[model samples]
Structure formats: C-alpha cells, structure tokens
Target: MTDTLIKLAVQAQFRTRPTLRSVVAQMLTEHLQEKYPPLTLPVAQLRLALPREGGGRGLSPLVEVALDYLASGIFPDLTARDGLDAYLSDASGTRLSFEQNGTRHYDLAVVEALIRELPVIVQVGFQDALMAYWNMPSDAGGSRWQWFAGILQDQLRAAAIRQLAGDVPALQRINQLTDYPARETRSQRHGPESSLHAYSVQTRLVQGETQVTVQSSDLLLVDGKQVWLCNLSGRIEAYASLDAFGQALGSAHGRPVYRRQPHLATL
Candidate 1:
C-alpha cells in the first residue's frame, strides 16, 4: 500500500478519537493482517518473546518501531542501546509493563539490549523491510507490504536456522563437517563466512503413502566436493557431491523418484 493510503487510514481513525496508542496499533495490525498473511505466525512468535502484560501477548517491537517511523518520518536510532531505549520510550504510550511484587513497573533495557545485539545481517534485513514498505518503487507489482513481509520472513527464518545450528544435533554435526581444516583456517583469518544454502526436495514414498508428497525443504552446505544435507527430522547426511545426493535419494525402491530444486538462501 502507498503512504497516502496509510495516512488516510490514520486520519480516518482520528475521527473516532480513540486512545492514540490503541488506535495506531489496531490500525497497523489490521493492515498487516490484510497485506501480509504469511507473517502472522512469525510475528506472533516474536511478540511472545517480548514481555507481556494484562494477560495479552506483547506487540512486536518491530511493529512498534515501524509505527514510530511512519508517524515521525525518522527511523529509530538502533545504533546504540541508549538510543533504542529512548526511541521505544518516546514512540508509544502503551508501555510493555509488568507487575513486580504488586507494583506496576516497566523497563526498556532488555528490549534495547536485544535490539543492540541483533546480528548485522538481521539488522540490515529489518531496515530493508521497513524501507520497502515506506519507499516502495512506483513500478513494483503486488502489494509493497507483501514484499516487506517476505523480507521479514527471510530474516526470521535465517535467525531460526542459526539458533537451530546450536540446538539441533544434526545441524551441529553438519556445521562441523562443513568446517574442514582448510575452511576453518580461511574463516579464522578472514572472519567467518556465510555457508548456509536452502534447497527444496520433492520425494514420493510409494511404499507407504501411495500419493506424491512434498517433503519439507532442507538446508544444504556445499564445501568443495562435499555436500551436507539437514532434513526436517534433524537428520544429517553427507554426500560426495550434489549428484551423489540426488542418486542416494533416487536409490529408494518401489519405483519412487524425487525432484530437487535450488532455493535462494535469502539471508
């Protein structure tokens, strides 16, 4: 949607003269739901990570920041913890507070720290998403909000995969396997590099379910002649090459065949 549409909606809401915080938030949330249906689950998960109050899930800090930027035309200063603290404090009247020992209190320190410590790439991704929504190109097709939503999804998915690397045994093993001596040395000397790649594999298991079923997309890390695959079940398999990986999948019985497609790893 265009800025004119958003500004008009905000103006219309002003006719009701509702609470500023509630009106702005409700408007933004409704717009988000209409323009970006795919973001609902991820945004909900992010909201859960924030401190909640009054038995309601916390609103996403990104959404709060977006609202501030839209209203003020000045992006939040995410460069420092203190800047983030000030921005969040000044942006909205709805404080994400909690009751401590029967006393109501609020603190932005934790949220500020979280924002400050966000990975550089993730920070960039969020900035891009916001910019896409605010300064959409005239020739762009479909809703600019949907494009913004896709970028947010990619960022969240990448963050989840990074977290999984530490938590999932199979992913951890894949990481280790991909980190050979040469690669480790290179990374140590030039800083760590991004190696994660995504691929979609469609396989049919004729023996069990006689229907063609699509398998969950997998993460792949290709290093030289070796390729590592991490499936949805946290199973890690090593193949000498991409061809070998495909051959292994094709080796299954019952006249079963599989199709593979490369996916853009938009991290």
Candidate 2:
C-alpha cells in the first residue's frame, strides 16, 4: 500500500512543482481501512526540496536532514518519547527534532495524543518504511533507528520553550501561515542555491484592500523570518516573515499598501 501510494506521487512531484510523498499517509490510511476505519482525507502532501550535489541549504532531501540531525546525537543508551512524526529523549541529550515525513508541521503532541493514542503500530511501520526509504543497510538498521531516537533526545533536551518551539525557528515561523485558512502557494523555483516558494495572499483591510503577492526569479530566499517579494518593476516588496505577511493579508492592508493581485497564470 505504501509503495503504491508513493508511486502515484512520483508524477505529483512534477505536476505540483514540489514532489509529494504519501507513504506515511497511505500506511495509516490502509491500516485504518483494515481496522474498519479510514483517515479523514487522502494524506499525500509535502514538497520534497531534493538537494543538489554541490551542497546548498534547501537542497538536501528532508529525510537526510532529519537523519543527519538525529545521527549527530545518537548515543549508547536512552529511551524516547515517540512523536508520530519524529522522536525525542527520555534521558539527557541536546534539544532538537525533525520529521522523516516531509510536511512542515504537526498537531501539538499532547493534542495529537488525545487525538490518536500514539498508535504504536504506526510507529513501528513508520520506522521500517523510513529506513527502507533511505535504503539503510539491514544490519545497521537498529543503529539507524537509534539515530532517529537520538534526534528525539536532542530535541527533548532543548531549552524549555525552544524544545516545544521547533527544529528551525526561522522556518517554523514561515510555516505558521499554512495553518491560516486563506494562505495559498503562488509559485515555486528550484535551483542550486536554494528552493523558493511564493504565496498569494489576501491581506487584512482595516482601511483598504491590499494583498501579499510577489514576483520572482531563478533564485530567492526564505529564512522563514522574512520573504522577499518583488513586483513587475523589479522592485522588491519585502515581507517581514510569512506570519507577518499572513496577518497583513488576513487582517487589513496598511503601510506601503498593496491591493492588486499579481498575475500568476504563468507560474
């Protein structure tokens, strides 16, 4: 089921610009079907920012990033409080975490647990699939699993608020916009330096109607704190962050106002 779902996704990557993976979503969906239940929706989402060879930030495969982060913390003995998407330590370690599934967000764990009861089988299968997806050697799969476990530990060990905050605060801030009902992806660019995604937005109108949209090129930046938006005139209309842009879009337009929705048909 998982492999079938993933196969469907290969084409989706091209169609969607960012490739989508449905393995986890499918596994759970199928498991639910077998259990006489079903997931609420078709669960494939996640635009893999497949990394380039020369080495750039956004280019690395997300799994590799998550795996590398976890591997950095792997130790001899420790237990993890499993996060369905990732994991963390029950013993002493640094504070960090990452998800093998490429989506940028998760329901807060406490709320998630109340919603899904940890579903340990999902964890077991997820670990197995993640290993296979990465082509991990069978003999060292245990240690590889431990690497993921170590990632959980590192995150669990983070400073109080930071632990719960996220893996990368800058990127995390940008992701919050996706949760808002109105936000939409406008465009995407893939190249050696970094991957760029543009969004179309209907900003707030405390006084007048203004939107958050931008122009782009082969290269762009999204540190999560700020996204640079350029207009047809080649002037950059900057967004302080995805959230700031979202609030401005959802609220009302103001300072350095904008209202005309840019033509995105070409994108």
Candidate 3:
C-alpha cells in the first residue's frame, strides 16, 4: 500500500507542490476504495513520517527510518528513559538543567517525558545524516560516517546557537521567515569567511493602492535596510538601497507575502 501510494504520487502530474496528505487521500479514495477516517489524521501523518518495520519496502519515509536505524544500531541500548535523559546532555556531556539565564523555559520533567514519548521529534534530518553515512562514496576513507555525523551535528548546533547565545528573537524571526527549506547551497565567495549569508524573502509593497511583490533567492544579508540583494553568480539580481528595501517590507496589514516571483515582473 505504501509503495503503491508513493509511486502514484511521484507519477501524478500537478501544477502545485504535492503534499503527503493529499497523495494519501487520493490513494485511499481512488486506489483502495476507502475513505480516511476522521480520527486517523494523526495516524496518517505519523505513517507518512515513519517507515514500516523491517526492510525491502520501496519509498519509505527516510527521516523516521533513520531515527529507527540510529536507535537500533548506533545506540542499541537506548530505552525510553535513555532518550529522555539524552536530551539534557550538551555536546560537552554537561547536563543542561533547563536553567539558562536564571529562568526556566521548560519543565525538565515535561520535556523529558515528551522526548521519551516522541523521540523522532527531538531533531530533524536523522535519516539524511544516516544516508550520507551509508551512501558515502568509496573514494572517502577513514570514518566516513563520523565525518558525515560531524557536519550534521554542526548544522544542528548552529540552529540552536541563538538559544545557546541568548538571542531568542533573532532565532524566532529566522524560524518565522524561513518556513520553507533554506537555500543550503553556498557559493565559495559567500562562505563563512564573509559576514554575508544567502537568504530568500518575499516583500510586499503598496504602490499607489496596488500591491506589488518582490521575492528572490539571491537576497544576501537579510537584515532590513542594509541588504546585498545582488546575485553573486553573475546573474546581477538586485542591489537596492536601504530605504527602497525597507519600503518593500513595509506593506499594509492583511497582505500576504508570496514565496517568489519573476525579478523583472516585480520591478
């Protein structure tokens, strides 16, 4: 059932982005001659995120499978209690007491219980990290999984850096604006050596009672006003002035920001 659903989903032609729920609904309706039970929404979501027990099935959710693989393989001894306690430990093995800034953000017991109950929700991309490890090419030598794990670990660490450094609002804004997958591909010139970071943003502006939308992937340095919107890959996107960019972000209430649109059309 899972394999058939995924195959049909991949084959289905659509004008918009495909969602797991929509695919599953179509499958149950057309293929299986069944209607999705109202109470099964949570189960449906969970099944979409998890792979079936044992192997040989094609097109399983890689993320959940990765978590299961990690639980059984790398940390074979892990139990519910172990997962709960594991969340409290930092990279240096120091136990976090949930007492940062002399204020507690979460009850330790509550968080521990949550972790114990839903271990997969602890983090994302476990399957991606695991796949990178398993699928490492023969050319790479000496602890390939370790290298992959290290990079994945670093990315996870970076995501939490704001919370670690006590910049909660910056982290919140980042999470808010970056609802879609971030542009992970980095250019050599735009790497860590430079202070600039690539970002995608949609800015809605009101021009004489008409709503205009500006969106781009080449938007480097997202800090409003002082932005380097130019595409460094010789595309020559935009290098708008501070006030011009600010106005783009300062639209009236109830206006929706688009994901992206043509550059020249926005202008």
Query: What do the candidate models score in CA lDDT, each in turn?
Result: 0.45, 0.35, 0.36
Task: Give the Å shift of residue 4 in candidate 1.
Answer: 48
Clashing pairs in model 1?
A: none
- TM per candidate comes to 0.25, 0.17, 0.22
The digit string of per-residue lDDT tens for model 3 on 1-267 reads: 243553454344122333433333333223212221222222222222112234221222323333454365432222234123222222333333333557442233432233243344323333443444455542234354444434333343354452324756444333332332233333242343432344456655545557677664444344343343433222322335545654554533575443222232221
Candidate 2's displacement at residue 117, Å, is: 54
Ranking by lDDT: 1, 3, 2
Residue by residue across 121-202, what tens digits does model 2's lDDT show? Answer: 4456566665564443223244433544333223222321333244364334333322221223322222233334444333
Best by lDDT: 1
Q: Each candidate: how many clashes? A: 0, 22, 0
Pairs that collide in candidate 3 are none
Across residues 99-213, which tens digit of lDDT does each residue of candidate 1 receive?
4567343334544333343332334445554554445432234454444434333443444465555657435434343342244554565457634343446555454434555
Residue 86, candidate 3: Cα error in Å is 30
